[model samples]
Target: MFLPFSRYLAFALLSIHETVCTELGTSPFNLRPFSINLSSGVRTMLNKIKTTELPHFPEYPGVGSSFGIDLNTLKSLRKEWLTSFDWGKEQDSMNQFNHFEATIEDLTIHFIHEKSSDPDAIPLLLLHGWPGSFLEFLPVIDQLVQTATTSLGKSISFDVIVPSLPGFVFSSPPPANWTVHDTARVFNTLMTDVLGYSTFAVHGTDFGVGPGYALYDEFNKTTRAAHFVFLPFYPLKPDALQALNITLSPLEKFEEQEFIQWDSSGSGYFLEQSTKPNTLGLALYDTPVGQLAWIGEKFISWSDPHAGTGGSVLDSNEILRSVSLYYLTRSFISSLYIYAQNPHGFATEYTKAHTNAPMLFSAFKYNVAFWPPALAEKVGNLVLYRNHESGGHFPGLENPSALIEDLREIGTYWTT
Candidate 1:
């Protein structure tokens, strides 16, 4: 009787241990010596989560027509990547900018911490969004530094910090229940604690937009100001706006149209990212061609369709370079995990939070999303709402001179 009871207890403990390890993306059947001692009680609480399967890209009639790049050309380009691309060369190019990492709370954040040789440089934080790394802003750094020098004076250059967002490239994934706000806090530490800057200006677009504001909130007293290419659709709760007697103007009506378009057309990536990133990550992780196509679809839509915007909206060379970073680092899944396990209600919470600081917005016309000047004013101060005749999401990359000039003008108003 004693032997049978002991065997039953051992089996129960093994089951529990397996459950716990599987839940956390680890294998439980390791033959390692360390597996022998875990208490049955500790393992019982763990639940296994099944990773979902990603979807197939359905062949569409006009998909290739969007970029004017024929199927044959794309096929050949992909072949070249498999045969000729050098990730080592690309890695070296990325390292050309100074690199630094800082641990804040639960994260080890990787960033390009480029301090201008000019001693009087202003500290500027540049944040990148999903599918973007520090390299996204590389093409335009010179222009930005120049703008800072000219507007803030030669003595006033900019020390720029561009971090890989949590779950992106070099940064680690979020802790158990972390949200974008949590990511923002880490960034604040980087700014205030690590870099030792009491005040700095900030800029971001896409998923990076929200954190940019959080940085402003974190540095409420001293952060000079914040700027974003993508602005949140405010008054998060539809019912609340009705209760508050909020009203939007004619321009607001037009901006709403753009917002609706974004939701309808620009949201496929959002849906997949927020709900099933892990599943998609599997495909991206295993096949480089699949990863390129996954990212290539977005590159076409976001950049000028004609490729006129910053070298074909994205060059074949650049896509491979970007994808290579994901592949070599083996970060595709971990990075995508940020979207999968993002804190459940952070976006809603952020948009609806009660903050009295008036907002300043610059809405570009061709951006995938933007608030019409009228709607933005209704939401906040909307200090600068200018429509560009050209340029899209990657404004700085697409039209550097125009973006620099605009930033210079916007700088004068905010810096004072």
Candidate 2:
């Protein structure tokens, strides 16, 4: 029942969705305001999909899902999406956040600005990375607004702001050469100039680490403290490590080996997106089934293996929501531009904060990359580092409770 729309049909559907949304006032990028939802036409098309038509290929011998997305799992997920997934429910949940748009450099920035009623609540910028939208942090917003207490009974809470990274859902696409450093400047403006916060905190993961680090480094005066579940450091190859005479402990060896294996095997997305994203985007962005396989594979391969939701930790519902947003906003291709615009890919250069802001990092066991504390220390003032046996790259989705606690704990050291 799985069929890819012809490239023309796929792009047409994409264009229709965008055009229809624009015409209906569902997604107005004029910077006034906007709401998010899958159009009725698109929903009908999705519901009418023939999942059973997907050609069944024999599963690869022994490799299973290690090589790519498992067709069987994808079929099951697609069926679930077509038959049982509820976009309205997900959209309602997202609407619970105070969403607003602000124009920055001619780009309309969409963000969730949820302030805790507590007057003393700390302002924290929660940034999401690629293949993820503001949806990544929705699960933890309720918890973040609650009073967070320390062992001493001292309490804290957060006024959370989650922005759709430029070119992401609801946010207008960026101009060429828009690096995360540029994003960092825009975000600072959002927090300071637009939101009118004199001091704030930050938490980042994946590509989010770029802007989060820039705010932590370049705007140390306003960015009081920061936290991260991932960083942007480039992993040195085995030869490079040997050349530097770098010694690895047994655990570091295991981690480094995992990284090497990922670089050799799992880095096609990075290379393709960085070098020739338009081709990749043209091929997949407009097709729902194609989008499913492309994004769905990452959710499968990059998540904690022993966890639930078909080994992805989070459920297919979230995956479907991701696919839906990418489709409705026609943002998949533009989202990849972050990679194309910042062609250095990961980093040989580590971020150094100019001020002594407390930086907390949570090292999730299943995350795609691991930088030991020694190297990570070079990136900032490493005040709090927690090693977790659970979670992965999308910790906000995979382990929201853990991510929430990490965010909560960051406040304890805010003034230290």
Candidate 3:
């Protein structure tokens, strides 16, 4: 799980429309809420799929989709996409939540702002990582805003702010030199200045861990706490763990091997996306099926096979919805910009610990990136940590209930 420590200095967006950046200071009035309907161009592209064809894939594999996404799965997804997947209905469902666009730092940031009726609801920011969009949060956004009284008899709810990290969906792209640090700064501004929250709790996974940690480190006074499903910085090495008189549990050892296997077979996209984005971006920008196979591979490889939210079991419909949105908005490539702009993929710092903010981590057994709790505790003020046998990378999709519970639990530590 250990890579070079210096690489994190690099890893770090695109716009749907042409919103020019003017010198306007941040304000809530600058934001506009609206519904997004499928455009004529996107509708035509989806229609063309019925007649257009995908080439056949010759059989060559031990496991289906192990080397890459297998052909059979790819075709199956396309079939579901054409038949049962309804983008208009899905768009209507998404629009039910309050979606907004605001000009901040010359970038038109897109986000889902769901506020609970509870005047005392905890202000929380939920950040999504790569291989996901703001859509990933759709399953749980409504649930998160609902009032919940924990088993401990504590009542809690959230004013959830889920922003599309600069270049992913409708949000504008960052400048070429921007990194996650820049993202952290802008997001801090969004929460405190733009939305005008006095304080907020943060949760992150995958690519989100970078900016989430950055907010925790830099804006200690405003960002009260953090909960993460993944930490870019890893736990201490096995030898280092032993020297520290710590022993790995059987599950930890097994997960470590699984993590290694993932690096070998499942992570080629990271390198290509990080090192040569433009070359790869052009190749799949327009081809729907191609984009499907490319992004479709990760949802299968990273999830707990039996896991997901509600009836939405991270199924073909769900997968295609993700790819289709990215394809239609022309953001599949723009999202990849984070990789190239920040080449420090998994090599984030493991040694430094900042305790100003209370840190809670949700450790899923199959997350691919494994870190022991003992070493993880050294990274921050480890207040609450839980391990789950279910869910993988995108908990918002895989286990919305668990993700929601964790966010509520973390919110309790915040004081007025």
Candidate 4:
């Protein structure tokens, strides 16, 4: 049986505190400098994927027949990834940023710590969701950290912290029974106890929203503000929509149509991941092409259609880098366990007016899930909500400039 939200939060906090003291011999955790050096053995395995022959299947021309990633797209990506893509170059680019690890509870969390020169910069925690590693934030971290002159002539910046969720990429996997709430508690320890910040703001999309909401609810005093590109527990009830006293706009209606269509046909991955993750996990573990097909399909489908082009908004290199990380670390299977552990989904009770932290929501045009401004207001102290004309689920990569500008707006609300 699942525990009540309040009890779960309390127990999680106590557990993290005890683990920190016992393991590290300190009440608060400490950050240890780290480096990411991929082994030669892993590199050899990745190179082997390029030469491996993929089985050919005849294509039929129809939406249902092509319900998944087209065979042609996967073949092209595999060829380029094997022959031309440079993992070393990508690794060096990632290493240019400050990276560190800290033991919080039973997991050793890996994160990028980018600091701004501005003394007044606020600490901002950026979290990434499934099929996405901390890599999703790489394109925008520099802009977020750079000092920007506002309309009032004041400068603003952020001390950005992007962590690999436990069991994803560099972070160690949690116990078999771990849930998102467990991640939330460990992350709170990261900010307050490890990093020594009394208050911070959070921004998240996809699975990141689970822990993001957890922080907003359980540590409102410390999580001073929150911003989201996706709210996992949304589509407010009909009565809740009535309470907001507003009608859906044309854009919102389009979002609804898209959402319904996806729920009917595109939710197979969700059901499988949340129910029999290990079963699927084992099947895909040793096969590089299988992992690519599973993850690359989402990257292609969920992104905004390329403007004036016929494919995904993401470039070839962008998609390959994400897949390469999973393939290299052999952590693809562990990442899926997060879904199995939290089969019930994000806690709905926390979504109901649990905190007064200033909240902001951005609805990207092509996101699978969309929440209107009125509906968003019911969840928290809705301070700013906007609809974008471009971008999709992965706004950080698809439209970095837009995402950065909106985050700066959050900084203004935070300082005021």
Who wins the TM-score comparison?
A: 3
Model 4 residue 63 lDDT? Answer: 49
Q: Per-prediction RMSD in angstroms?
A: 15.2, 8.8, 8.4, 8.2
- lDDT by candidate, in order shown: 0.58, 0.78, 0.75, 0.79
lDDT of 4 by residue, 1-416 (tens): 34445334433554555567658666544456566777564567665686677758635645432489887788888888878888888887777666778888868899887777677888999999999998888878888878985445567798899999999989998999998889989998898888778999999899998888788878888898899988757464435556767677888777766666667788799889998999999998877778888998888788787731332336878888888888888899999988888876554543554777788899888888767876677677888888887788888888777788888777667842
Give lDDT tens digits, candidate 1, residues 1-416: 12234233433454454466558756422211111111231212111001212223425545653443345545655666656655556665565555555566757677766555555566778887767777677766655554353344533456677888887777777675666677777788777766667777777776776677666655565456666666544322324444656555555444445556666666677778788877888866756556666675565566644445433234667777776666555677776665666535233333322334435556554566655444455433345555665565666555556555544443444452
My TM-score estimates for the predictions, one after another, are: 0.71, 0.86, 0.88, 0.87
Clashes in candidate 3: how many?
A: 5
TM-score: the better of candidates 2 and 4: 4
TM-score ranking, best first: 3, 4, 2, 1
Which portions of model 4 show Cα errors greater than 4 Å? 1-30, 59-65, 149-154, 236-246, 307-313, 347-350
Question: Which is the leading candidate under lDDT?
Answer: 4
Cα error, candidate 3, residue 186 (Å): 1.2
lDDT tens readout by residue for model 2, 1-416: 22223323433443455567668875433333345655664754484455325666744656668778877888888888888887777776666555677777778899877667688999999999988989888878878877878535669898888999999888889888899989999999888776668999999988888888888889888999999877767867667677766776665666666677777899899888898989989987657788888898887677776555432347778888888888778888999899988877477876667989998888776777877666678878897777766677788888887788878877778772
| Residue ranges of candidate 2 with Cα displaced over 4 Å | 1-33, 44-53, 59-62, 236-254, 309-313
Give me candidate 4's TM-score against the actual structure: 0.87
User: What alpha-carbon RMSD in Å does predicted model 1 have with respect to the real structure?
Assistant: 15.2
Name the 10 consecutive residues with the lowest summed lDDT in model 2.
Answer: 1-10
Q: Where is model 4 poorest over a 10-residue stretch in terms of lDDT?
A: 1-10
Better of 3 and 4 by TM-score: 3
